[model samples]
Target chain A: MREFQLIEKIFKPLTKGCDAAQCLADDAAKISLKKNEELVISKDVMVENVHFLSDDGGFKIASKLLRVNLSDLAASGATPLYYMLGFSKTKDCDEKFLREFARGLKSVQDEFDLCLIGGDTVRSQEKFFSVTIFGKVKKWQILSRNQAKEGDLIFVSGTIGDAFIGFTKACESMKYFSQRHFFPTPRIELGKQLLAKKLSKCAIDISDGLLADLRHICHASKLDAEVFLTKIPFSIHAQKILKQVQDGGRVCSHPELVSGSKFTTLDLLSHGDDYELIFAVNPKNRKKILHLAKSLKLDLTCIGEFKKSTQKKFEVVLRNEKNQKIKIKKFGYEHF
Target chain B: MREFQLIEKIFKPLTKGCDAAQCLADDAAKISLKKNEELVISKDVMVENVHFLSDDGGFKIASKLLRVNLSDLAASGATPLYYMLGFSKTKDCDEKFLREFARGLKSVQDEFDLCLIGGDTVRSQEKFFSVTIFGKVKKWQILSRNQAKEGDLIFVSGTIGDAFIGFTKACESMKYFSQRHFFPTPRIELGKQLLAKKLSKCAIDISDGLLADLRHICHASKLDAEVFLTKIPFSIHAQKILKQVQDGGRVCSHPELVSGSKFTTLDLLSHGDDYELIFAVNPKNRKKILHLAKSLKLDLTCIGEFKKSTQKKFEVVLRNEKNQKIKIKKFGYEHF
Candidate 1:
């Protein structure tokens, strides 16, 4: 199908009820904010083989792309409003692929109450999708990473390392792992609850793993952090995988893991794509946060705390269950 | 350089002095809109070896990407504010290329009084750049293509077909053509003047060639348009190229043009990449618009008028100087 046909037949319907979209006919979209509201925006790009397998269906690829971008807004404590997509379709992306992609987008947009606004669609040899999301938050209420105060208790929502294990298992035809790897919850409600209840003012999403993202907060706040390995939350599946590796069982078949190296629990802490929210809260508000978490039915774990740093360079210390500092190399994934 | 180092050493400097950018430290950027103001947003993506030559320098590629996206905001009569960029770099994009790209972005951002707010940088096998730009316009003042009325005079800013000629000549190492093809002026001020003075309420930027873009307005407004070939403004260089093609001179060396076919004037009207503004104005405001154009030192041509369409599918008729209708096979470039 031609670009216009794909837009008219598949993408245009996604903007049906959005008056601001202007039926996707205008050159650009116009949006208005309430008097006391401010706009929050973020963009994320995903390549075909680098980010997802080429054989992955459009639905899975589209869902992961939108979810990761939504995670950014969730970290900012903003409500999702709209999104603009830039898709460069490869030769293999036919009408069926586009239809499924649009369906996936519609599913997420319906769940988040956001609509498509404007974007560009083109053809390329290598397929990649980029999304720019716009959300709204109360004036002066944006939660930033630099707001972490000294002596603040650190917390992370949901299970960690599941995505890493899921990625490994998915490569071996594991459905559960594939599902976990592809469909991540963005924690939008928890983000808003934390800000609205004044429970926390500092937060970052765990896209680049726990330690690396925590270091981002520490670096921004000009402080240091200490995280206990035992306190880090892990799912039943991830724990089983860790046990198998520790018991001299078959290690992960991933190229990076199987190349003359043993797979260890530390690998879980350093791998990314978890999409969970890690935040800092005042010690006084700890009970309130836990209570909020119980009401929301989310697993909120207190894994660490922020500390004052005398040195200019901030550091994140990971300690073992025995209370000994664990030496580490390579915090998380780094794209060059 | 690693991704973080590249961002810290190069791209982060582009966010300086933008309070909303948060020193490039946050997951998302926050923006506040004044009362009676609405946000205008647009996105454009350019792929190497497709939208541009792979050998093109970062400065030229960066400038063209921003300019094309800015043209969308110009069509909506919006004032530039902020932008988010998503770039996928190939192995060939070294530190020098990134520095040059940043420099080009700084040049345009300074001239346009805008700043980079947030973006993502990642690695890819094929390089591509996507930009999402944000601007502001007064409430109820956005120029929409669907607002054109019957008897509205069709107007075009600057010249047409220069970019096509430039594309052709640049393929043969013509410096003048290379400059024209690489750099385009976005008609922001003219769009603002038209809307502020109530001279027009309909406009579409000519990125998809003259007839194709005019058809966009006609399709949106449910009207037909008639453009006279003689009245269509063309630069001296474009005129020379057209004369050469007519006189059977050395035809363009572009692969598409030289493949057992004669390059004609119709190809010029059907080809795209000209970032000029095509708009509609009330006949009564023609003199005022011409006056405004003279003050701005821009050539604004009155090429045609919109007429009521009897059929469902709108048509754009091209008339020769002899008042005879000219047939065109393709309207403009389409990516499929």
Candidate 2:
């Protein structure tokens, strides 16, 4: 089928009743916001083999691409509204692939209340997908990474290291762990709650590992951070894997999982791909946030605190149970 | 430099005083619209060796990517406001490339009164660029391709065949035509005049050639088109090339320019990459649009008229000076 026909058949339904989309027949899409609301925009690009495995199916690839960008909106405490997808795929991609991809996109759009407004599809040698999401937030309720104060306590929602553990479990064909790596649950409600109730001034969705992303907030706020090693949250599955690595004195039995040798509590904290929310709150708002988390039924863990930085540069200090700093060379992945 | 530092040193200055951009240090950017205004959004993706040559410098590649999306916004009479860029490059792409790319972006943003908002940068095996542009238009002044009515007079802004001519001239090292192909002047003001003055109900940008884009309007509006070959506009450079093709009997001296052997007026109309404006108007509004065009100092040509389609599917009829139908086999480029 031709590009237009493919888009019409597989993608048009994604627009549904959105008048702003113009049924995808116009050169561009139109969207109008209600008064007192501002548009939040973010774009995320994912390339095959780099962002996802070459064997990943269309549904998984599509879900991961959309969810990662949605996580960005979640970081800003914005509601998902509309998005434009720029997709390029090799000739090997066929109608069935597009059908499943569109199905995955539709499912996410329905779940998130987002409409596919406009985008472009082209041919490329490899798969390159970029999602530009436009969401909405009350004018004064928007959150930023630079708003965290020096004396604020840092909090994280949801368990960390599950995605990193999932990456290691992919070799074992552990569907649950692998799926966790593929599909991240963006903390949209938690973010909105933090913003609307003024529970937090600064927040960042964990795309880069916790420590790395925390460094971003601290750097932007001109502060330092102290994270307690025992305070870091990990899923039961991740904990089990970490136990096996330490007790057996072996990282992984599978030869393909060579990166497992790098497994450590610190590595779990530093390995990227955790799409949870890490944020900062004023000390006075701790009780209120705990109550809010319970009411929202979200797992919120306080792992660290921001401190006034004497060097005027951000630094993250990892402390053991005795509050002694540990010597670690690498804290996160660096893309050059 | 790491990703964050790369973005800070190269992309942050593009944000300057735009508070909505969050200084490019946040997860997303925010934009607010004036009362009664709607946002116009469009995305265009360009892949290396497909949309452009692999050897094209960063400045030219960046200009092409941004300008293409701007053309989409101009088709709908939207005033440029802000844009997000999704860029992926191989390991070989260095700081110098980013500096030039950002410079090109800044130049275009300044000329269009738009700001760099938010986006993503990632590493890929090849260069892939996507630009998502957001523009604003008054709700009632917005235009669509589906609004064209039967008996509507068709008008095209500027020349049509320059881009196709430029593609052929690339081998001859002809700067003028090649530059036209590289840098298209989007009819932003003309589109605004047509919509704000209510002179045209429907419009489309000529990207997939004039005939192809005209067909898109007709197909969407449930109408057919009658294009007068002689009335189609052509730039002076394109005219000279066409004269050479007709009189010299030598399509091109360079073997690399063998594609020029396919040169014909019909070929010019059918080829893609002409980023001009094509819109449908009520015949009575002709005098007004002409006056508006004159005042705006833009070249406007009436090349066709939309007619009610009896068979439902749209068709384009190419006519000669004697009003005789011409047998044309192709309309435009279609990506599968």
In order, candidate lDDTs are 0.87, 0.83
Best candidate according to lDDT:
1
Alpha-carbon TM-score of each model against the true structure: 0.97, 0.96
Tens-digit lDDT track of model 2 for B1-336: 578777878888887668788888897999888879998989899988778765667888887788888999889899998888887868778878887788888878877888888888888888889988988899777878888888889998888877777666533467877777778877788878788788987889988878788889888888999999999998777777787777754364323346446477888888878888899889999899889989989888898899988887798898999999999888886665
Deviating ranges (above 4 Å) for candidate 2 = A170-173, A249-262, B170-173, B248-260
Error of 1 at B173 (Å): 6.6
lDDT value, residue A212 of candidate 1 = 94
Model 1 docking tier (incorrect/acceptable/medium/high): high
Best candidate per DockQ, number? 1
